[model samples]
Target chain A: MTTWDGAAAAERVAIISDQDVVRVRQLVRTLAVAVKLSLVDQTKIVTAASELARNTLVYGGGGNAEVSRVDNGRKPGIRIVFADEGPGIPDLDLALTDGYTTGGGMGLGLSGARRLVDEFEIDTEVGKGTTISVTKWCR
Target chain B: MERVPVLKIGDILLVSIQIDMEDQVALQLQEDLADKIVVTGCHGVIIDISALDIVDSFVGRTLATIASVSKVLDADTVVVGMRPAVAITLVELGLSLPGIRTALNVELGMKLLAQEREQYELDLEDEDEEPAVSTR
Candidate 1:
């Protein structure tokens, strides 16, 4: 099991509007670069954050994203958690399936975000909300 | 709402996306491009995305929509200057950006647009020369 050390840096950005999504992307990119991730990895994580952030805003009806720089015993990584108090995902499997979307999107947000990050976790309830945590470690 | 500017050079409309655009902004740019295509009577549209660090699904879809919209307006659209890293990430994200033509840089994209225009003119001339020749 991988255990993360305390975050060296952290920030939260609201995902309530379209511009907030862009801000989330910028925040993730800054943290990814600070973590010393490769260019491709940085791009991947930032893109994933953009997708998830949009999901928070569009489908979740509004949310927040927390970006953090963390370290395991040997390597540094960036982790982002997106949380929203909107309609929870009814079907986790279907939500993770590519081309499956309830929000009129391309259905690539969840699945594509999973492919981009090294670690992914989701917590949700039917009436409560959804929180997705994704991490990309330096290699 | 910040707007992406569209500049006209010769018969082509050039759009260099310099901002980290919001979703609404992306859609707005698509509408603006469609209008510009008709107003300028351009034959081609070149969208330069070199400044963009990442092209997520929304932006990718927007670009494809812009390409298809331009096609309906009788203009070819070429997306140019995608960074190597962005390309790798976009492919991994399962977005191949279908229906949108791409080039390495603006210069090459311009060349492609010119070639496409020349080919179109040639095809038109061929049709005019032999009206009975089957277009199939």
Candidate 2:
């Protein structure tokens, strides 16, 4: 439904709804400066962002994308979490592998996101929902 | 907290898009980019799609359009981070773009920008020098 910076933190952005992929990317564009993400990295993040948003819209029926800054004392990074309450991926392992998509895309949404970021994680329950987290560090 | 949140940097001016070597969206992106460059004066543009699982004719045409438009706008363009499988698919499909600048990764695309900028500056200097020489 909307994309806004965190309620309490300026660095965080919460995107709600199936149509918020563009909004999430817009948020990323705004934060690119502080994050120092390269032009290519930005595209990678946006592409994955768009894919995830679409997945929620098409498959999950709706969901939210949450983004925030991450710090581990040494490096600063961007963290994005996508949550959807759809049917969930039936095969987690096959779904993560490239060239194995049931959807119309290149089947690289999850894999591509993994490749683009420094860290990637996914959790799903067949009947419950799915949550994916990805992070890219800024040096 | 009532703090006004403003985008700190300049509209995140630079963005490189990597589309499947053959996607119709790529062409639309070209038109979209042309308009942005005309209005915003952005510097970075990278289009890398190494994980493209498919490449069709429409996608091919779109890629060509994006390359051509970006060049006309004097924007730096780089086709980087292409997946080998995708590349093979494109080649097998015989899809090719005439003038899209290409590199292996986003890093290479950034390097290309440096070179392109230097060339642009030198061309401007040449134009400036020519006017002075003609006066004498």
Candidate 3:
């Protein structure tokens, strides 16, 4: 279910387990390279995608990641959205804290991923799981 | 279980993470490394991660655990050949990898490990030859 139109080159993959995290990183890297993002930006975006994919697996159970190359006005960028249908975050503020984790993680995925990207947004419900979207623009 | 082969170079054990690291593969590497360290009695371990483009939190934790375990077995560990981009990403990921030694390339890493082993030998010799004497 994408409303991205034809302008954006997009792909989706399941984030079900640890192997899926590797796949998500590869997909994000492919899109970032295709858009000619600098090596630093590519690494940042790929790492961010990895953290989110793991979160979708470990925290949110199983989910999927949507990666797209987009144009934000004249600037070209890559956007990744991760969606999960498992138990949702109970408190957004606490989850975004730098050293808070519920599942034995280093507790840096949310805040660290946010720092790596140009934009970040998250939506969650008590019982409806979560959606976290991030974008990294070429610099 | 997916196993990562550990190559023996003199007294140094070298493991290059060249493939996509599945969680099982990482665990296997840890188990195999413990056994190899005991059997080979290698004094140093060098992990080459240059081929790995990204190291997430879990992988980072695994590497740290490997280093710690090797340390307990009297083997020093050095991680070498991290890409510049991966370094930056690691910083952003907030994993400092404290107490883990890292070098730029395999050659440099080998040199560092040699120096470390030399120092360890010197320390042992001093322990055997010299006794702590209290001078009142």
Candidate 4:
């Protein structure tokens, strides 16, 4: 259980299993509607959530996520934070590259998920863990 | 292990992915689809993903694989009801789903399959006649 600023997140969930991927997608849908994101934005962010959730389970070896309604003084947005304490990534550049995978995926999870969001952030340690946070603003 | 139901309509297989699939379930659905296509001798497969709001890489690859697998089995696959957002995300994700056909809805998907089938039969007939002429 990683500690996060719950003040930012209106809801949170765990991502410890394969099925949790689906649950996280569902949770994203809920937040998407709550934030009244357009249908396209909703799908994009939800799809992003699906990718990150799978990464949390498969690569990060299970983690947790938080969804929050955020404002940057310009527009309202929904922020997603995925944190995990699994075997931390040793190489951030390789991990972010398209078609790069330690796991047997197409290597689109990280790069692809990045394209679908408005803002993306990544923090990782060699032995500790990784934390990824993203935002999708309502247009 | 949740299995997506495969419904047979005439000689066509209808697979609607209504729920977000686990990895196991997605793989299972792929296997089951292959079996169903063979068992039913389906000439066409229409996969409806309208209910799928979010298509991650896994799901996207599963769909692409399903399309190619059905083609190898001599069946046409038409993915239907792809939301605009899903399509945009797939392209950005570098999943073009090449060689896989898509339509706006099931009705249009069925139409595409029918057109493909007709063209295939026409090509077959043309080949048959060409062999006769060459042999003569």
Candidate 5:
């Protein structure tokens, strides 16, 4: 488990399976309310969490997503990490590219998740697993 | 630390959106589903916005695409449980959906789709009965 300890404002939560997406989303909702993220920031985080959890279900072969609060000195933010032991991305570059979906419709999971966060990162190994980290700070 | 849970009920595609939706994500959804909606073949789409506090042009665009794509896929699209504040924000942003249907709940959306399908079939029948005009 990659653990992060930031300001006291941070609250950490974990998602272990597809069933956890709703739980994680609900936690984020409460935190968003507590922090009072701007309309745009709130939407961004909520959508980001939803997309990331969807990724966990579709690509991760079911994994865990951890949610927490990040205080960036200037503003408070939300963070999410989606990790899976399923077949790791064989081609990270290609996976991030738009219109390159192996699943239904176009591939927007990773890219869309990136867009919803103030900061985003991904770590993966083929045949091993993958982890996606996202942070959204209020403007 | 906890895991997020998700439940998929057929092709309904239920998701709890964030309060603030981003521009790039919205555009991605629009482009991704641009050629996929069909109004006569699909069951319908349900987007849950109960967690959201605001809606932006990007989100509005994505939702609109879902609606448009559902038509192309012969499916119907509906946005469920929108917050009042978010609605006002969308209106203020001048965000509007095109060629899409919406409902306050999932049941209503399904019903709407059923009605639309019946109407579409009737329209098709009417067209079939009309005399064909040949350019030749």
Candidate 6:
């Protein structure tokens, strides 16, 4: 359904601390700009990456984020995958709902991140792990 | 942790964020602002964020908290210089930042604070002019 440019085009950043969240935003911005996304689109993806990256650290107990260029035959896009081996989300539906959060956050991280990107996919298993992938296509 | 400097200009505190703020840094700024408000007894705070690339939920929430804290300390807070792209993304993320005042730039923000200070002084004067009637 989706294709990437190559393995070499991907960059991985560790999401272990608060500083890592800032790193994630920077990485996403660089990749988004390289793909020639609009300025607004670049901001959107960077913000979404920051949210997801923080989720990985605070909720997932640390993780890794992979950023790469994607292609869907029509145009080039940016795709980011955040993978974590910590406790997975028990309630996917509740987690996706706005204003619902186990953490003390505003509960807008997951839902807001989803809204900022064009494609969002989540894979999780209770007590196992969680992986969230999002893509933003150039317009 | 790196700290954001808060400069005092007259009765207003100015903070121009010039770094990619981490969570700890944001929290530190909040605490620092509260302390500075008490020590300096400033009437207004203007936070400049034009240099920030993105304002996520964490940053947005922090700004709102700072505004509330400043209000409780009897000071008005005005966030200024949000990039157009950041504003669009913030709206899309469903963070309207209610109860927090915003301005296009520092000059406008300063103007707003000055007007608020004037109105506050007028209200105090009116209260002082009120005749007190106490029943013995």
All candidates' lDDT scores?
Answer: 0.91, 0.59, 0.88, 0.86, 0.63, 0.93
Sorting all predicted structures by DockQ, with the top scorer first, yields 1, 6, 4, 3, 5, 2
* TM match of model 5 to true structure: 0.55
Native RMSD of candidate 1 (Å) = 4.5
Q: Write the per-residue lDDT of candidate 4 for residues A65-110, one digit (tens) a residue.
A: 9878887777678898999998888988988899898788889989
Candidate 2 lDDT over A12-68, as tens digits, reads 334454225556666655554456666555555555555565566556767877777
Q: Model 1 Cα displacement at B75 (Å)?
A: 0.5
Clashing pairs in 4: none
Tell me the spans in candidate 4 whose CA falls farther than 4 Å from its real position: A1-9, B126-136
Assess the local accuracy of residue A137 in candidate 4 as a C-alpha lDDT between 0 and 100.
95
DockQ result, candidate 2: 0.04
- The residue pairs found clashing in candidate 6 are none
Weakest 10 consecutive residues, lDDT, candidate 4 chain B?
B127-136
Q: Write the per-residue lDDT of candidate 6 for residues B31-82, one digit (tens) a residue.
A: 9999999999998999999999899999999999999999999999999999
Show where candidate 3 strays beyond 4 Å: A1-6, B127-136
lDDT of 4 by residue, B1-136 (tens): 7789999998789999887788899999999999999998999999999987767788878888999999899999999998887888778777887778999999999999988987787677866465433322
Candidate 3 i-RMS: 1.3
Best by DockQ: 1
How far residue B99's Cα lies from its native spot in candidate 4, in Å, is 2.3
Worst 10 residues of 6 chain B by lDDT: B127-136
Model 2 misplaced stretches (Cα beyond 4 Å): A1-19, B1-136
For model 2, give the interface RMSD: 9.3
lDDT of 6 at B72: 96
Q: Is the docking of candidate 4 incorrect, acceptable, medium or high quality?
A: medium
> Which one wins by DockQ: 2 or 3?
3
Q: What's the best-to-worst order under TM-score?
A: 6, 1, 3, 4, 5, 2
**DockQ for every prediction shown:** 0.85, 0.04, 0.65, 0.72, 0.10, 0.81
List the candidate numbers ranked by lDDT, top first. 6, 1, 3, 4, 5, 2
Judge candidate 2 against the unseen true structure and give its global Cα lDDT, from 0 to 1. 0.59
When 1 and 2 are scored with lDDT, the better candidate is 1
Docking level for model 3 = medium
Output the worst ten-in-a-row residue range by lDDT, candidate 3 chain B.
Answer: B127-136
Q: Pick the candidate with the highest lDDT.
A: 6
